[model samples]
Structure formats: structure tokens, C-alpha cells
Target: MTSMIRMFSLAVTAMLFGLCFAAPASAQATRTWISGVGDDVNPCSRTAPCKTWAGAISKTAAGGEIDCLDPGGFGSVTITKSITLDCAEGIGGAAGGILNSGVPGVTINDPNGGTTPTIKVTLRNLTIDGAGVTQGTYGVRFLSGKSLTLQNVSIMNQGTGSVPAVSFEPSAASVGATLHMTDVDIVNVQNQGVYITPVSGVAVSAFLNRVTITQAAIGFKVEAGGTATLIDSNLSNNGRALWTASGAATANLEGVTIAGSLEAAVFATNGTTIRLSNVGLYNNAFGIKTTGTGIVQSFGNNRLGPDAGSIGLPTATVTQK
Candidate 1:
């Protein structure tokens, strides 16, 4: 009947070109899985999983990986590219897999004249809980990434007022950004527990290992041309534990433990530079406070004070061990 109606119009034009080439090859899934009974239109599959890390980061694959197959709360995620949000194994530990009350439980905005100019983010074993319930100003708000890695993470009670539970301020096109925190724990953050500001002329760097900054008003706030390297860290009961400000800020504290700081366990101001090794300044009212032309370089196996107050500047230098 006219050659079977032109072979059913050439099989409906090859089934509409195989459904437009299989819908972008199934939306480019390099790896994507998120389950707490997932269903973000079911394609984020490790058996169709997807129940938020903003729906498995829109079916992940730009440098993909979003694996968390058991515990839930996986909300609040605004990472633009280069991803890896691994909840290492024990899926539901911190009150059943949470990223509570969120506004920023992870926001790494990457996209400025793209061709993947930067953007590298990796967060593992996550337990970001702001259940003290203002629910987020930041528990990782690195506003434009080049690199940010946090392992065994636990950023607690995120701040609302002065906002900082890991906020590496980067946006002058994400200026020289880099931060790597291992075995991290930033607790009760109501102001500043790791806020490395880098946007004036780009120079941000941070490397903290075995970190812990508790009860923060300010524990590690390295501003202005920043640089920080704290190992085996613990800055406790903070009003201000380590605050290096303005001029070319640099803080390299090793084996640190600054306790009960009702202000200043090392507060280097304007012309900042603080380098203390094997540090432990307990019950701090001021174990090391250097003013406007600040500099505290003590590399002694440091353990200062019963009733601490050591103000230095005879061109501050101490090398006792």
C-alpha cells in the first residue's frame, strides 16, 4: 500500500534518533548514589538512589562521586563542579546522618569563565550538624573553589551571627584558594572557628591536621594575605584562641593546644606573624599578645603559664627547648 506506507515512515525516524542520543548518555553519571529511600526522579542510581545532596548533585559527573547509601539528612549542597561527597561507611552516626537546619552545609560555587579553571572539592565522613538550630551560615562556605578538602569531618552548631565554621573567603575569582583539613572537628561555632579571609590580593593557604576548634568565638582567624599551618590542633573554649590579623598574616603553630582562651592564646595584630612550636598555652588570658606591629616567634617546646600573660616585643624571639 505504497510500500507499507514508506516502511512506517522509516521506523519513526529511527525512533526519534534513539531518543535524542539516550538523553545525554543518561545524564553523564560517573558515580552517583544517595539513599535514605531515594527518588529524585530516579536516575541517580546505585539502584536508583537520590535523596538529596541536592539530589545527588544533579546526577553527578563533572568529576563525580556522591556516595552515601544508608543514612539520611543529606541536604544543603551548592557545589558547582568537581565533586566528591563521601560519607565513609558508617552512614548514620551523628544523630542519623545529618546536615541540619541548612543554609550552608557545603557551598563551593565554582564557575567563572569556565573550562574547569579550578574547582576541586572533597569532603568525607560528613557529620555537619547545626542542631543548635540556626541551621547555617556556614559549615563550609568556600565561596568559589580551587581546592578544599576535609576528611572525617564534623562541623557543629554553625554560627549565625558572625558566621564561620570553615569559611575560606574566596572570590576575587577565587583567589589562590587552598585548604586541607584532616580529621576535622569544629564545634559550637558561633563566630569564628577557621575563617581564613583571602580576597584582597589573593594568598590563602591552610593545612590543618587532626584539627579541633571548640566553643568558638574566634579560634584561628588568619586574615590578610593569609597562611596557616597548624598540626595536631586544638583551640579550646575560645573567645579568641589564635587571631592573626592584617599585614601579611602567617601562623605556623605545631602540635598546638591553646585552652580556655577568654581571649588571646596568641593574638598577633596588624603586622602579624606568629610561629610557635609544640605549643600549649593553658588558661589563657593572654599567653602571647602582640599589637599593631605584631610578631611572636617562639619555637621552644612551649608550655606557658599558670595565670598566663606573656606580651612580647623586644623584637619578639624565643628559642628555648
Candidate 2:
């Protein structure tokens, strides 16, 4: 017939040039699955789940992990690599893994750069609620991350003003940042319930275990040259529970417990530096206050009850242990 119709038009132009040169099947993925009636164009896997957490963190990969196959409200999320947001079981019915408002509720920026200079973020069993009315300031916001780990988390209310329920400032070409809070629980935070300021030759370090800070106005606030380590922690009804202000700040309270602070349960000022072991002070109005060139280093199995006292300068350093 005309050479079989020109060989059927050259076999349909070589099958449309092999379907336009194929190759399109990588959606990252190292482990990504979010539910609550998922569907972020599906592909988050695990039965095709993905509804939030910024759509399964772009199909997870950089240090992967975005599990939460059930609980829904997976909203707030702005992490940059080195991930892990394990909802630690119990999601939808709410047993950790809520995240409302979206003000912060998790925002760790990791400028890892080449050769992986550092980048690690692991938040497990979250429950960050800021229903104290439009909560959106901070409930976890560590800039330029290099390390942040919070287990069994639970950050509440979140002040609409001063804002803080875990806020670590690290950026100045960031080269230092580390925080590890275990069994964390910061309630009614309207200000400083863990706020470390570092950005002056950067350097921030923290490690609070069994942490718990209530109704904050300040329940752990390490300033500029940050450094902290509070174990078996608990700073109650705060208005000021444990503040190490200004530069050169440093704290190390072990087995800590400072109660009802209408102000000053342990406020070391500008030139701060504190270290108290086996500590415990009740009904604080001033259990260990210091100003200007602050310094307090008591370590004799402390338990300063009777409304506690130990005000300022003379560099109170009682160590009989």
C-alpha cells in the first residue's frame, strides 16, 4: 500500500520517543507516614498516608522519620533535615501528639552546610497546645539547630506576650547549640519556661531531665552565654524560678525543686553563675537572689525552707559536702 503506510508512520515516532525519556519516580522517602484521613497527594506510604507536618516533610529523607499513622492535627513543622517526629503512639485520641495554633510547636532550622557540621532534632510524644487563646508565639523554636531532643513532651498555654515554652536562640553563624529535655512538661507558659539566649560568639547547652516548670514568667532562663544542667527538675508556680541573666550565664542545679516563686526563687543577674546540688527551696520570694556580679555556689545537700533566703553579693559560696 505505500510501503505499508510508511511503516506505520515510523512506529508512532518511536513510541513518542520512549514516553518522553522516562525517569520520574523518586519522592524521597526514608520513612514518611501521617494519617488522620491523610492525602497530601498521597505517597507518604504506609498505606499511602500524609495529611500534614507540611505534607510528610516533603516525603521525608534527610535523616528521615515522620511517623504518626493516626493522630490528625499534624500541622506546625519547619525543620530543615536531621528529623524524627515520632508521635510515640496515642495520637488522635490525644496522649501526646497534638500541636495546635502552629505559632511554633516545632521549628528547628538546621543550616548543616557541608560535611555535616551538626544537625539533629528528635521530638517524641508531643502535645504542644497553645489554646490559651490564639497561641502562636513559641512552644518550641530553636533556630539554626545543631541538636535538640525532647522526649515525652508537653508544652502548654504558651503566653501570647513574652512567649516561651522552649525557645533557644542560636544564630551568629551558629556553631553551638544543644538541648536535651526528658519527660518534659512546661505548663501555662506565658514567658520563660526554658529560654536560652546565645548569640555572641554563640554557645548554648542544656540538659534538663524529668523537667517540669509551671505557670511561667521565668522558670529557667539562661542568658546570652548560656549553659545549664538541671536534673530531676521542677520549678513551680513561677514569676521567676531560676533565671541566670545576661552574659557569662551558667547554671547546674541537681535534684532541683524551687517552689511558689512570686519572684526570685533563684535569680542570678548579669555576670551570673550558679551551682546548687541536691537543691530544694520552698515558697520562694528570694531563696537565692543575686545581682550585678551574681554568684551562688551552695552544695551541702541544700533544702532552704522557711521561706528561703540567701540574697546577693558576698558571693554566697557554702559548700560543706
Candidate 3:
């Protein structure tokens, strides 16, 4: 009996020793921090923040937020889960910045069955700069995501090959992705400022409020399976201010302004349609150009400048009730 009792005591002691020395599993934090002077190996806590946005994202929870500690170029990051990066409420009102070259400033690709398992992203109070010469490919390249909201965001100098400031081309699984842009400004983009061209048979929608696009090939382009509404927005000095290509693409403009377009102010082709209400077209080569059975319906409340090279008549003037 004494021998058995001694063996039992020894086993219990050994088990407790192993439990104490074993390493604890790593768990993501509900909130992570990033700073210019921080290190990536840190825990991303307030006192021990990470160095870059890419570093802190791995430490942050799926639906959590990563906040900036101060003014820093957090570097380019790829988001694969639902998260928010808010720099407006950080230590100072210093907006977070991303300076990218030869790559996208931000990429949001959230597929299903991942750890987070959601496809929503929000970006606020940031400036994405595609540095000149070796400029980045895209300011924001959204391949697969449910929705993306940009508030007070500025993207500029994306002079690469046919890359827009914001590209929303979702995959089949990411169909019906929604985009909301408020107080957003895009400048000097090589392609369209905002391109909403999803995959075939997949529809996407966009809402633009107080958005501005300047010095681009096209300000806003909506292709097949795409729809957009622009309110109180400005598209100026572009090859084409607004364009809807292919079938099933629709665009509505209200209280919007198109000025100094080298080509037509509004171009619709391939059975697409555009509706205008309370819109102003000034100093453009043409007010509205439609081809290939495309249509432009006006509510007769638009202001077209008399100096335009030509003003294409609307297919029909809609009567207000």
C-alpha cells in the first residue's frame, strides 16, 4: 500500500510540472495598435504596438479594429477579414497614410470559411499615395468582399497601367458587393477614378456622396452587372466624366457636375442606360453621347451649357409626378 501511494504522488507532481512550463497558445487581441516607432514582434498592445498595418492585422481579432498611435505611413496592407482601421480618433487628428509603389495600397479579399468568415471592411481618415514614377498599381483593389465603405479617404497619383483609384471587381463568391463612398477624392488616376465592373452574372452597386474625381481617363465607369448613383459629386477634366459600357449597366446622377471632359461628358454604349436629374454639364466636348442602342433619360431638370460642342438629346424626358 505504501509503494502504490508513493507512485501516485510522483505522477501527480510530474503532470503539474509539465503544465506549468508549457507555452500558452497565442490568441488574437480584440484591438491592436500600430506606431512608427514600434516593432512587429511586440504584442500590439497600447504600450507595445506593432510597426506596420500588416503586422498589427495578424494580431487583431477578425472583427476588431487597428488604430494608429500617431502619424505614420502604416504601409500597404491586405485585409482578409472584417475589420476597421480608424485614424480619425487616434492620438492626434493626424490621418494615417499609405505610400505604395508597384503594388496596391490596400487589398480586401475575404473568402468564406476563414477564421473570421466575414467580408466587410471600413477605411476612414487615410490618404493613399501611389508615389510618382514608380507609382502603385491601384489605390484600393477589392477582389473579393461583401462591402467596402470609404469615409474621408483620398487616393492620388495612381499612374500605372490602366489601374483605377478604386477597383471593385468581385469574384463569383463575392457577388453583389456593395460600395459606399462619402467625402472621397481621387486624383490623377490612369484609368477611371472609380471602376465598378464585377464578374458576369454578378451585380454590384455603389453610392457616391460628395465624391470628386479629377484628371483621369474616366471619372466613373460602370460595366456589365454594375450600377451606381452619384449625388453632389464632381467629375472634371477627364477623358470621359461618366461611362456605362456593355449591357445591364446603369448610372444615375443627381446634383452632380461634369466639367472639362475631353470626350463626352456622359457616354453610354452597348445597351447601357444613364439617368440625369439636377445635373450640370459644362465646357465638355459633348453633353451626352449614346451608341449601340444605349439610352440617356433626363428629368429635364439638368443644366447644359450652351458652349458645349454638341448636346446629344436624351432618349426620353421623364416627367416628374
Candidate 4:
């Protein structure tokens, strides 16, 4: 047989030369994209996209989702897993952005510890610019997430290195970290525009709806094991527009609106606690300011706005049967 037909034609040419030196399978793409003239080596699919968001979050996948095909500045991103950076359908009407100056435009750290299950980040209709002048240290920095959602987001001018335009500081094992802001918008933040400090048996929690914190110097700050809640929010021109610092820190306001505070529009210190309903204390220079054994409770349908210069009276007035 002619040397067994030449050894079956050299074993089909050595199996096509080992399938042409095969080696291509580094999968990871549950949905990845980014544009503004994308090109991070393609494969971010949706027809070759990718150009920062740290190059399409390492090709997405791990609770994937990194959309936005039109509207750029997609830079600055440090999420570790569990993602979702939607541009909320403004694709062509221009939405997604990130013009940080020094650093930190979003950095949710997720190391995926022991039993896992700690990682959940979602940011929609983005726009986080820490205006220039070397401003920008945080426009979202939930260190080691367990939950952080911001809808219709917009964080601006984060005051150079003074930090805080959103910082749910977790760590200390990342205990129960959680924060949810809806229709959020924080502007001219120069520290504490939403800075819940956790880490020490960490038990942080924050929830603000229709939030809008402006010109902050402390427009919603909670420390210790932090806990905050606001509805129909609006803390404007702050210098201290609601702060519950230290220990059992807690703050809850309904139909909130503390305006033009040069200081004290509800501030509780040390062993904190603050609760008000139908809140609205405008032009405040003082209106419910407690210290040490701090406490401030009022359900008396609050609404003081005669350019409030001193309407402090609430250490317990809960008569809302």
C-alpha cells in the first residue's frame, strides 16, 4: 500500500498543524461597551466599543453591564465587581461623563470576602465632574460596597482634596454598607455633601430620595455607625445643614428642605439622634442644634422660614398621634 498511503498523508498533516496553533478563550462579557470613538482593542462588542471606564471594566462580566455608546468622557472608574454604569437612555442626547481633576470619580472597592455577597453598584445618567483647580478626591467612593445606587446622578466641583461629594466610607470588614440616592445631585461639594463615615462595627445605611445637596460644607453628614434617611430632600447652601456626628448617629427627615444654613439647620453631636417630619427650615443660622447627649425630635409639622436666624426648639416634641 505505498507505505500505508504515506501514513494517512502524514496524519492529515499533523491534524492541521494542531488546529493552527490554537489558543483563544479568555471569556468574560455579559455586556460591555463604551464609546466616544471607542477602541480598547475591540471585543467590548456592541460592534467594537471600549475607551475607558477603565477600558470597559476588564471586558465586563461579574454581574456585568457597562452601557453607553454615545456621550463620552467615560474615564475614571475603579469598581471591582457587580457593576452597572448605565447612561440612562440619553445616548445621543448626551449623558455619561466624568471629568475628575485629581482622582476618584468612582471607586467602589469589592474584594469579595469570605461568604461573598458584598458588591452591588449602580449609577445611572452619569455626570461627575470635579471641576478643575485640582479638585476631585471623591465623587463617589463607597469603599468596599454592599450596595450603592444613584439614579439620575450628577456630582460636581468636589472642592480640591477636601473630599466628599458622596463617600459612604465602609471597611472594617465592610459591614452592612448601603446607600441609595434617587434623582441625586450634589454640587460645589467641599467636604460632607453626603459623607456617612463607617468602620467600627460598621453599620452604615443611607437613603435619600429626590436628593439635592448644594454648596456643602456639611449638608448631610453622619458618623459613628451612621444611619440617615431623607425624603423629598434638599439641603442647600450648607455649612451645616443637618449633621449627626459620633456614636449612635442617626438622622431622619421627611419632606426635607433645610436651606441656606451658615451653621445649624439641625445638628446633633456626640451621642446623636435627629428626627423631624414635614421638615422645612429655611435660611437657617440656627434651628435645632444639640450637643453631647444630643437629641432633636419634632413631628410638629415643621416649617420655619422667616429667614430663620434662630428657631431652635426641638429636643422632643413628638405629638403626632
Writing each residue's lDDT as its tens digit, candidate 1 over 251-303 gives 89888888888877888886888888778787776678777688888766677
lDDT of each: 0.79, 0.78, 0.87, 0.83
Ranked candidates, highest TM-score first: 3, 1, 4, 2
Collision count of model 4: 0
TM-score of candidate 1 to 2 decimals: 0.42
Point out the worst 10-residue segment of candidate 3 by lDDT: 110-119
Task: State TM-scores per candidate.
Answer: 0.42, 0.41, 0.91, 0.41
- Candidate 2 deviates by what RMSD? 12.9
Tens-digit per-residue lDDT, 14-111, candidate 3 = 99999998866578988888888989999999899898889999988888888888877889999988998877765433567788877899999876
Best model per TM-score? 3
Task: Give me the runs in candidate 1 sitting further than 4 Å from their true place.
Answer: 10-14, 17-35, 39-41, 44-49, 52-55, 58-154, 157-173, 176-192, 195-218, 223-236, 239-242, 245-247, 250-266, 273-284, 295-321
For model 2, how does the per-residue alpha-carbon lDDT over 4-110 read when each residue is reduced to its tens digit?
98999889988888878865576587777787788888888878877787888877888877778665567777888788888764333233355666377777877
- Best by the lDDT measure: 3
lDDT at 196 for candidate 4?
92
lDDT of 4 at 139: 88
> What's the candidate order when arranged by decreasing lDDT?
3, 4, 1, 2
* Quality of model 4 by C-alpha lDDT: 0.83
